[model samples]
Target: MSSDPLPSFPFLNPGEFRSICSSFVNRVTGYSGDLRTLGWTNVKQDYQDGSAMLIISRIIDLPQWANGEQNDEGSCLQDDIEDDDPEMLIRPSSISGTSKVEMEYHILLSPTYQVPVLHFFFKNTLYSGPNALEIVYEHLVPPAYRSDLKQVGVMGGISMTNHPISGIPVYFIHPCNTASALQTVQGKEAPTAETYLPLWLGLIGNCVGLYIPKELFASLRNNSDD
Candidate 1:
């Protein structure tokens, strides 16, 4: 981790971080890239305020443990979606994980701050409550981030919510102002790939029962041109 700010985000811009995720998802799923750059910044999530949010997101394949019948394909949203749009980008349907095991990742950035938020949605499953989240927080995340989830609107912290949409519940995990959580190997205080990516993959992957070694992220670090 460098003394410089946000060693985690190579370009210090959310867009670049978005591309990094795009590349990572691509490598893991082997699917045609469907990453979407959201149009609005004020997109609402539980326990969050409307702010300058630059978000890049996508819905990808789920872990096998997220067992359930895959939902039927959504009706064509061509009329509602933008041209060249890989997926629907309008209405609540703009997000694809309805009544199924949808793995959605959102990389969020704010103009007023440098550290970004790591947010994801685990939708349409039985794991939709504070109890489930407690199991994850206590077992998966490090002690430093164990308390982060309780701070919903804090600048550099984390939060969790089990909110339902149209009676369909989803589990949401949000890590805000992530720079504050990055502690280096040498006992330095900095946010770098050495720290951020492992923590992100660990907590999120554990909830889905996926194993993601930090070494697997080498592709993302090398593919900066994306």
Candidate 2:
């Protein structure tokens, strides 16, 4: 058996994080992009200035009604919308049907929190209407978790900040209470490196619209039983 020890929940050491990230990269390979109808793609591990991270990309379709333009009345909602409120002042644009936008996600271990943090942004440059944060709130944030994610500076909120290494402005789901949040779903059993990421993605990734295929989980189960 390998000598590596399994990582503890709520926190992950650098070595353990790398091991889990590598396993995650492999699991997502050939299972995303054009290979699957609805899944992430461009999965790989990369390093910059000695830090390791996992990167993945996907194209998401937004319904025409997802537009965030203000109505002709020229009124706008207050900037201080309550954290518990998911309702937004959005109006449909002239565009019809659905529109696609390519989104990229960067998963890196946080030095302070000792947990994985997700940084993501869409790839379009010319597209304009609302800022990244506004777009995320309007189209990506699920109504179920909208309130919790609005509580910035606290757990369960989506934070808009600059990338630690790249210095690029990006949006990330807060990792502050990731451990406690994960504990609720992880149960009493210790999680293996192979299993950690899928669990993390299920609990955390969904905040920003990342979802793993159910069939992939079934495939992993079958492989483990062999």
Candidate 3:
């Protein structure tokens, strides 16, 4: 390994982001389970400025409870959600069991925050609307994170905004406080390139229902031992 100093905690330069994306994708591909289960791919846009984004597009069956199939009282989310409270923005929406949901996640380097920002786009088999955010809130976000996400400033909570690269409306976890969150998770010491992306995915990805399988880490350990 090169002795070059690691980038500051929670922040990665563009070059570092590309390098880590490749390493992270390769590590996940080594997973023993079906590769499609993890659904991670490293994609670099061939625009004038080559930019890479870690992409994961997958279809998930909403929980039975959220689908309003089990219980009589269906989800109370509205078709259009206004950002009245950045902290608590989810309202009841009409989503049925037949609605197919395909969620696409993009992890890109944020020039302003110097950290990776997770931008997610939701495509519904029925229709796409503000209710998409409701699906994320009700299905993807954990009960523990739902409350903290309301503290937008402190937690760098979830918000809907235009994607920087695509300029399309999408939901993303705010990256402003990412450095602070990583510090708490990773401790005071800086992590190397090999370790940084994994640590980051654990913190940020978990918020939106993305997870790195334990098998990936097991493979990493086995490789190091060899």
Best by lDDT: 2
Of the pair 1 and 2, which is ahead by lDDT?
2
Cα lDDT computed for each candidate against the true fold: 0.37, 0.67, 0.65
Off by over 4 Å in 3: 1-5, 38-48, 63-100, 124-127, 224-226
Q: Taking the tens digit of each residue's C-alpha lDDT, what string does model 2 give over 92-199?
A: 356657666667889999988888999886654222222436668777877876777887523367766777777755678878888877777887765777778888
Clashing pairs in 1: none
TM-score of each: 0.39, 0.77, 0.74
The list of candidate 1 runs beyond 4 A from truth reads 1-11, 26-104, 129-132, 135-158, 161-177, 183-211, 214-226
Q: How would the candidate models be sorted by lDDT, starting from the highest? A: 2, 3, 1
lDDT of 1 by residue, 124-223 (tens): 3333333445534543345554454456422233345322222222344443433443332223543343334445444443333333533344544444
Poorly placed runs, candidate 2 (over 4 Å): 1-7, 30-34, 63-97, 126-130, 152-155
Query: Candidate 3, 46: how far from true, in Å?
Result: 7.8
Residue pairs that clash (backbone atoms under 3 angstroms), model 3 = 76-92, 76-93, 77-91, 77-92, 77-93, 78-92, 78-93
TM-score of 3: 0.74
Tell me which of candidates 1 and 3 scores higher on lDDT: 3
Q: Which ten residues in a row have the lowest lDDT in candidate 3?
A: 74-83
